[model samples]
Target: MSETTRSDVIVIGAGMAGASVADALSRDCTVVLLERESHPGYHTTGRSAALFAPVYGPAPIRALTRASAAFMANPPEGFADSPILTPRGALFIAREDQLADLTGLHNELQSEGNFKELDDSGIRKMHPLIREGYAAAGLYDENCQDIDVAALHQGFLRRARARGCSLFTRADVIALEELANGWRVRTPVGTFEAPCVINAAGAWADELGQKAGAEPIGLVPKRRTAMQIAAPAGAKIGGWPIAVDVAEEFYVKPVAQQLLLSPANENPDVPCDVQPDEMDIAICVDRVERAFDLRVGRIETRWAGLRSFVADKCPVAGFSAAVPGFFWLAGQGGYGIQTAPALAELAAALVLGKPMPPEMVIEGVELSSLAPERLSA
Candidate 1:
């Protein structure tokens, strides 16, 4: 038998969720970060559209994203070499038939975002590529920005390492058990035991929970496909804001000279290295051509990733009621990157039995909603 390594906490999955929480907890606890893939962020963390929209997601998620703005705007020194967020406004478009949905969305986000509803002329003026008469109305948000995902993710891992957190990539967890006073994780590398375990396994979060004799969190992994295409006829897209359908059927964001398109699909899928489906790509292309004046001559690049979610769509970040010391930190869905900072702080406080961060409390983050017991019970 290989020698057993021990730590105060064992964090499963080294993607953004695991990395961020590990970084936060490393300040006061001995943490062992384990990744199943050859490298961290091989999945969703590296494949996001990488936007920071404070008005996005559920109320809990919006509160978390709002709390994360400070960190995104001004990360700790040496966390990242470049600015973590860059200004890139967002424009939500609505067809005549979809105007009602747009109005409801505006009402819901009026207090959450720096935005305003626009008329037909305004949508065309803001997004020149929009087909004339296709969009009946729009909402322009000036506060949205592009999140530097790589920098943020790498910074979290680097900071955790500097704080003495040990990250072991390719440490595929085969088994997990809650010990009398701790937890034992069996992986290819070795047997690692810790006083507590955090299941940040992304798509496989529920699977990991079952291994630890904990009740299911009802996690479901969904497929979302994205592709890159060249800009239209030498058009300058550097300053263009992301254009999205009001109902979220599709979205197009300018990335340098190229445009990134997605159908905003939520097709249920099993955990694995997900790939873009041909049908999804076809659907995305159809939507893009109808919504915009541009033509997709060729797909510069295409990929797919999984977003895990539970019933409420809010993140789960508490200990299992049936299994002591087993923490649930999964079900981030598509909001993981933007919400990582606040979630990490909240997770650390929960792991260490500390009070919720006052800043998060001020932002109206209620802890009970995120408790694992809500799902397990």
Candidate 2:
């Protein structure tokens, strides 16, 4: 390898999770943030639907999102030129057979956020485009909003840079060696050493663990495809809520002068630069047509991204029990962006051997739920 540069910590990956954690750690540690891509957030982070819905994920994820709500609502001064979140509300619709599911979700999320049950007519009133017989009941969360994903990612990067964190792009880690005092990481561009190594490689998290001789956490990367289509003629969609099926078969939301659609397909795949499958795109079109009165116009754009998950479907954070100084910040699934703030704070606290931040504690975040050791051998 070449001459070694040194830092207090090395973080692999520059997506939302990686950047947020790096920013939090940079306040105290010298951090080297590495990205295999030419730019940060060129993968999943850049392709996110960017919804800040606290009631969107599992219990642990919901807790993290709730903890992050304060930060998203009132970010640090000068973090972004504009607000990170805007009113966009969300409506989870269900057919007659799926009405039970909608009710269950409404009840389950009531403790976490404000969720109200709406009958078919009520749902249609909120979203007039929804076709009759497609939605028997729905769960509405008015607090849910659209997130400025790029701005959020950039804010984390800005904070990290301002705190003296070094960012290196196009630096693919080729080798990782654990030394008694630290880790030596070799990338194609250069070599660097750090006392601690954070595996924040998103879909490639388990691969990085194996490279470092750490125990595998069974991370699975699933592909999700999204596309935009022309809006219906003369339709006023600005006040339209994001409409999602209770079974997760499909979701449609109004964007500026266009409509965004997703089939919510979760096809298992290896880590890669993903592209939307033709069949998946067809499925999305069919579902949207059946669910709404609008016609599917020309596809403006389409793309796919991977959402990584552990077997237990919870985020993995904290130091690895099998590898000294190896920390995990992976398996966030689709909740990474919405829950970034709290997860970053938790990871920072665990890595620095400090207590959980008061803000996180007040939001009832349980560190044990996201600890790396929770994933079994």
Candidate 3:
């Protein structure tokens, strides 16, 4: 026996992307949000090292981040009791051999963020933990900040529900049947039909697309691990900015009175519940200790998450050219949280057949860059 339901749109994941798009579209249409897990954001969204770094991704991603800046900085009233962004600057440090890379990055990001180049002494002054002679130069971006990811995800979910959107957790999508005018999605709980079906299943997006008979976009899910260690004695870590190697060999940041570190590994992986590897943790500790004066105490906790990317390493958004009413909102890579607002708005506008939002246009987001047709072409 099976139950049946219908809506104007069916979102096939309840993570940040799904929640944001559902919230946006629910304003004028019926929305059904489906999650495989018992709770929303049980995957990447929950495990994100959430940061709003405008200069983190490629040009298209930076444009989206710029477009989302206003929303993150000042969310709508009643969205959350506290602000979504908090002051937590970022420092990209480089050794002598990586000076050119650091300079290039700083030059490229000057237009997108407030980045200042610093010499070894300046870098040491900003973050004294770096061992002497390890970092020859650094780039500081004060505009980077910590993001309250839970608040943002909950805000989207709450807004969507308040607007009459239905959310179904533990609704594993087993099949997708394309109808003449809509889609029939069979899940464990019931069958949901909608004219528009959005694929926002994060790392499993390519699998969902194949299930829907859409062409694979060659999305690769990569594993990233992070572990927390006790803060060093007599050192106040709360005020220290996030420190990342210019080549992304490793990164460390303060979290909940502990130091969170990652080797910045991106091992190709299949979509599933990810776990941290002991070798990766050892690599992180080795890299951090070699670069900084801090010794690693016992790893208090550790975890891993997947960050999905396409060949071009840019997000895929917009309607599919082959499959009518099938939308592509995947391949966010590691920039999903920072660029959610703009991408959600863009997805909604495209779905509604409306013009690009003026703000997004001003932010210099070229629709062609994000269109799914680009993959086929």
Candidate 4:
């Protein structure tokens, strides 16, 4: 191992979270960013549906989404030529048989706030794609938007580069050891030392922590498959809103001239380059066909990605108490794309002894909830 490699901070994994952390920390310190892949965002970040809805998940995730809006509203200068968010409504459709589910979802929405109620006639007027038999009731959220994920990812990397941070792609960490003064990381290229190591390995976060001699946080990576299908002949789908069945069995949104669809399948999977299975695709087809009256066509392209979830389905971002100088920034589930900016800022604050935003430090989101010690209990 070459001895001349060191930085003030070392971040493993160059996906959205890792890239954001590296970029945020580089402003104050020399940062070394490492990625196992040849390029950043090749995994879950690239494979995301890129929605920026704040009222779609659990309380903690909703809080993160709310905290992230400021960044997404006005991203760093020159982050993208166009605005990050685009207006696209979201509708949660429910069938007559799903009355109970609709009631439960309505209660949850009431708890979350800002969702417009839609009766059967109102839902039919808004979305004609629903079959005649379906659409007992629905809820619409106008705040739901399409996130420019690629631009956001590039924005972070550009900022990192502008801050003189060194990003090392194709350099995977093979081993990590704690030194008296800092941490030593052995990568494919050489050995590096840093006062702290940020574990932003996404789905492989727990495994990476175990390799670094830190306790695992019980992170579970699940596979979610999405496919693009040919647009119906002469059908105007581009202007249609994003729609999902009440059961969440499937969701489809217009993407340019095609359609982006997902079965919302969450099967436990080992961390790797994921591929969609025929069964999953078939399930997606069944769900879509069941809800909509349109004739389904062939799938033009398909892929699967890992959405890593912590035990509580919330992001864990803080330093490890069991192993000092090691930080945890994983388990973002599908919210990583939407909440990257706030979570990264929080991580930077916790790591660099800066002040954290009060809104982001609320119930089950403070330093205590994020500490690695919670995994033991």
Candidate 5:
């Protein structure tokens, strides 16, 4: 509560990653978590379309997701009350022209592990919204599910609090400086000192590093828009599988009474309150109509958010070779929600010099793949 306080570690964002890191570290050392927003998950964390498809994304991301699946499937012994992931399979649609691309993707994912390929009938059975126009269909890993992001985040916070860690909301960090023994961060609330700083500031991660005089990591915040509509024609959204275009052009999923869809746009943006562009929504509806038999009706609501990514889109974790005591935990892309469990634990392990948790350190997660050194190399 003093103008400047000391802690064993300071986390620069209270979203999923920061909260999880704080929770992991709190058991061994005092942790201080700072959030710029009025509340946690107010930014991209709250805005995510919480899907946990282990086989989704590029190689490293998929690996991280696969590693995190066990924890998500069973959490820890006493992590939470209800299950974190609910059963919800995902379907990928392929138009006649897209069959080749879909085939290649299917083969690629299948080579990785558990994702299976489903026939056209299987896709329709899972997502009835598919119309007579599509040529073929594919199925991804059956273990995909909707993640209860808020509950998982709150669970981490609860654990951190129980371990005597401190959290400061609306404490936007404005500056970071290196000291003899640690780092000094200036925030809206006050200055705090920590032996190490975790840059989990989401979209503003690169800015945080810049404030501390660290080299740029090429963090880019890409905009993604989603809108809700009346369930497509005869589609009942509650249990429908997530329907995605084979080209990653657009995607749809059942939320409640209505359906959620997106055009998968990736325009560069700065961190802010993201709003859906009218053009983007229209394009999404057009693409949906083109792929399926559904007539786009009313758009009930729409929102947009930034999915921050590094140059290669793989997450940056581990200590910076240039900046002493600075760690990178950003560029999660859109996989943050699903990969949070493993990514956070990985960050903690690297910082504390502890043995890597077996489940998360799979094929491509070596330090070289995600180290800050890669930026300079």
Candidate 6:
């Protein structure tokens, strides 16, 4: 039998959520991060074509995202070699039938961002590739931007390691048992014990929770498929913002010399390395061609990623109601990357029993809103 290891905290999953929280928690606690995969972020984090849309997701998420923008715009010295955020606006478009949805969304987020409502002419002017007769209106969010996912993710891991946190790959938890003062986690590598165990296992969060006797959060990992297609020759697409269907049926965004397209599918799936469905790819092409003045002659690449969510569509954070010393940190949906910085800070503070940070307070973070008990009730 392997000798039992100990740490102040054990964070499972080593992806953005685990790494960022480990970075924050490592400031005062000895942290040990574990990932089942051979490498951290080999799953959803690495597959994500990430963007920072402050007005995205539900209220809690938007609040967290707003709280995160400052750090991403200006991270600490040595956090990363390159800037984490680059300007890349977002445009939510609507057909005539969906104009009311666009109007309602605009009113809801008017104060959340630098927003402007555009008519069809205005929409076409902003995104010339959009079919002239397709769009009836648009809501432009100028504050949205593309995220340097790799740098931000690596920076968190680097900082955590520098702060004396240990990271282990191929550490797939097989069993979890609660001791009088802490919890024991058995994995392929060996056994680890910590006073606090954070379940940030992404799609497998609920499964891990079961092993630890924690309450279920009803996390459903939904598959979102995307594909890359070549851009037209001589098209200056760099300045074009991501064009999203206001109804969220599909969307297209420029990625270097190509355009990334997706049907915005939310098919529920189990925890695994999900792949793009042929039907989803076909739907993507149909939607993109119908919305834009372009044709999908060939798809350069295609893949799928899981965006887990609970019933409320808000992220779960805080101690388990059913199990002591076990924390729940999952269900970020597609907004995980954008909201990581602030969410991690919030989770770390909660874990250490510290008062909520002023940053979160200023953003109107409801202390009990993200608690695991909320879902239990």
Across residues 20-55, which tens digit of lDDT does each residue of candidate 6 receive?
A: 999999999999999999999988888787899888
Tell me model 3's lDDT, rounded to 2 decimals.
0.93
User: Which has the higher lDDT value, candidate number 1 or candidate number 3?
Assistant: 1
By TM-score, how accurate is candidate 5? Answer: 0.95
Clashes of 6: 0
lDDT of 2 by residue, 221-339 (tens): 99999999888889899989999898899999899878999999999999999999999999999998899997787899999999999987899998888889999999999999999
Angstrom error of the Cα, residue 8, model 3: value is: 0.2
Using TM-score as the yardstick, the better of models 3 and 5 is 3
Clash-forming residue pairs, model 6: none
- How do these models rank on lDDT, best leading? 1, 3, 6, 2, 4, 5
Q: Per-candidate TM vs. native?
A: 0.99, 0.98, 0.98, 0.96, 0.95, 0.99
For residues 296-326, write the lDDT of model 5, one tens digit per residue.
8778888999999888888899887777899
The TM-score measured for candidate 6 stands at: 0.99
Shift of residue 358 alpha carbon in model 5, Å: 2.1
Q: What are the lDDT scores of the predictions, listed in order?
A: 0.94, 0.91, 0.93, 0.86, 0.85, 0.92
The candidate 5 region of ten consecutive residues with least summed lDDT is: 359-368
Where model 3 places Cα greater than 4 Å from the true spot, the runs are none
Span of ten consecutive residues with least summed lDDT in model 6? 367-376
Off by over 4 Å in 6: none
Ranked by lDDT, the better of candidates 5 and 6 is 6
RMSD of 4: 1.7
Residue-wise lDDT of candidate 1 within 157-201, one digit each (tens)?
Answer: 999999999999889999987678898899999899998999999
Top model by lDDT, which number? Answer: 1
Error (Å) of candidate 2 at residue 22 is: 0.9
